[model samples]
Target: MAVLSFDNVSILQEDVPTLQQVNLEMNEGDFAYLIGKTGSGKSTLFRSIYAELPINSGVARVAGYSLNDIKRSDIPFLRRKLGFVFQDFQLLTDRNVEKNLSFVLEATGHSNPDEIRFRIEQVLAQVGMSNAIQKRVHRLSGGEQQRVCIARAILNKPLLLLADEPTGHLDPEVSLEIMQLFKQLNQQGTAILMASHDYNTMRQVPGKLLKIEAGRIFPVNSLD
Candidate 1:
């Protein structure tokens, strides 16, 4: 089943054109890397999937919600079916790992404390961050924080994960580790569409490669 589809879609940033006539699709459990230079509209495309930016024309669907026709009140629910990870590790700095994961679970309608706790433990262990459940976000190392971010993103078992430069801030060694983690998640049945410029690491953890260039997205056989 297709979790994300964009057909001849046009996207704008600040009233300026970004991606135009873009068509793309990803099925359940698939992985694809979105590669582009800085300011090539990779993040803009990601935003459109989550309705953070509007699709100016054509059809766009994510996690079964139509971006063009989705209602304002439905946005939050739509997001519940999708996950987002960022380079900057968007965890709440004031909270410990458990609280951060709990916040997502509670906000998403999980009320049973025991179930929530179990789910938290499962995701944290999946990302190899179970031991840091009580550590403050700022106290963890860069890689540890990113692991927590991944943990938080998967709390609700999203159908698709939109990761924008998830390893952009980490060093090569740490970035490779995160890529391996992503591979494990993909193998376990979560579809992932990650925007990255880390060509070496991406090649090591191979997936379908798509490039955004000249206001469009298409497949590329090689990162070069």
Candidate 2:
């Protein structure tokens, strides 16, 4: 099954067309890289996928939710099946790591205390942050914070992960480490569509290539 699909979709930003007649698809467990210049439609496309932006035209579906026809009340449920990671860690800085993660569990309808604790432990261990569960979010280094963000993203066991410049802020070494972590996640069966501006770094990793230019998106064999 396709984790995400867009057929003849057009996306607009403030009445301006950004992506037009876009056709894309990603099957379960697929890994793809979305690359484009700074004013390209990458962000718009991501927003549309998560139902933040309205589909101007055409059929769109993500994780089994129809985008063009998805109701407002169902958006939250649609989001529950998908995870988002941004370049800037979007955690609650005042909260400790455990609090931040547990908040997500509760919000997503996990009520059992034991179940929540087990899920948190499982994700933290998967991201190599099991030891920092009680640490405050503000105290973690950039890499550690990003790891925490990844762990939080996966806490719900999403069918797909949307990452926007996840390594844009880290140093080269740390960025590589994060990329490896993403690779690990992909290998374990979660589909990933990552948007990145750093072509050199992104090209170093192996995945299907996609580029947005001239107000549209299409597959690419290489960055060159």
Candidate 3:
């Protein structure tokens, strides 16, 4: 199965349609860019895949869950298959980077001390933050913090990584570094679907591009 998908899915915010007849699929090892103006349904589509927003019409099968009428109990399972990265770091201010990452792994059922330590080290290495694990959240730079967030997201070795404007708060150089990290993860068969407005970042790297506008999706470019 494709890692993530939308089949004629439509989303509504009260009476307004946020997405219209959307149909798309992202395969394992695939990397794609999703872009549009603000309020153009970029987040609406992303949220729909994670079942954050209920589908008003059509069908969507995401992370192996039938989001059309998914059960509440099924949500946790679905979430485990996806690594969601947000623009905001959302780290625990009171905890160091290691503790913040450790909390999620334990909350998600990684209890072995050896395994937990190994998992933390592995993800940190992936994001080039092996040295920042012991640093307090406030002490790291904005770019480094965001990298930690990405590391936390992938600690479970998720099947798909969904990032919504992952680099919105970083400078160009830091943004490029973050994007390259994502590219590396995708190369290892972790499907990636990123939503962003940075046209230059997407241009330099290679990926399929889907543009969203006025509640619709379009294929503006493809480097597959």
Candidate 4:
């Protein structure tokens, strides 16, 4: 089944249309790249999928929820099925890595302390950050911080992962490490839809391409 689908959908930010008549689909275990120039509606489209931005029209479904008709109360449930990684590595600066991750678990209704710790360990291990559990966010390198962000996102075992320029700030070597981590997650049965500006990295780790331009989305035939 498709983890995400948008048919003739329009995305709007603050009542201004950003993408029009967008049609797309992502299936289970599918890994795809969302490529576009800045301000070309890539982030807006991502927001629409996660219901951060309202769908102005048409059919949209993600993680088995109908986005167009989703109620406010249902938004949380919709988000639970999605793991979002952002470019800025939005970790809480004041908290240690474990606390940051624990906050997510607590907010998501995970009350059992033992289970929370086990799950946290599992995700941190997945991202190769098990050793940084007690480190403060300020002390970790940018790549390590991003790994924490990824670990936090996967705490719920989301059906799809939505990443917006996850490697935008790191050096090429660090960026490659993060990409390899993402590829590993995709191989382990999670679908990924990542928005990226680094065309070189896209070429190195090729996948289905969804290119957005002038408020439209279409598949690219080749990276060349």
User: Taking the tens digit of each residue's C-alpha lDDT, what string does model 4 give over 84-111?
Assistant: 9999999999999999999999998999
lDDT of 2 by residue, 1-224 (tens): 89899999999899999999999998878999998898898989999999999999999999999998899999999999999999999999999999999999999999999999999999999999999999999999999999999999999889999999999999988888899899999999999999987666776777999999998899989888
Predictions in order: lDDT = 0.93, 0.93, 0.87, 0.92
> Which residue pairs show backbone clashes in model 3?
none
Ten contiguous residues minimizing lDDT sum, candidate 2? 197-206
Steric clashes per prediction:
0, 0, 0, 0
TM-score of 2: 0.97
Candidate 1 lDDT, 59-161, residue by residue in tens: 9999889999899999999999988899998889999999999999999899999999999999999999989999999999999999999998988889999
Error of 4 at 43 (Å): 1.3
Q: Could you give me the TM-score of model 4 versus the true structure?
A: 0.97
**Whole-model lDDT for model 4 versus the true structure?**
0.92
lDDT of 2 at 69: 89
| Model 2 misplaced stretches (Cα beyond 4 Å) | none
- Which portions of model 1 miss their true places by more than 4 Å? none
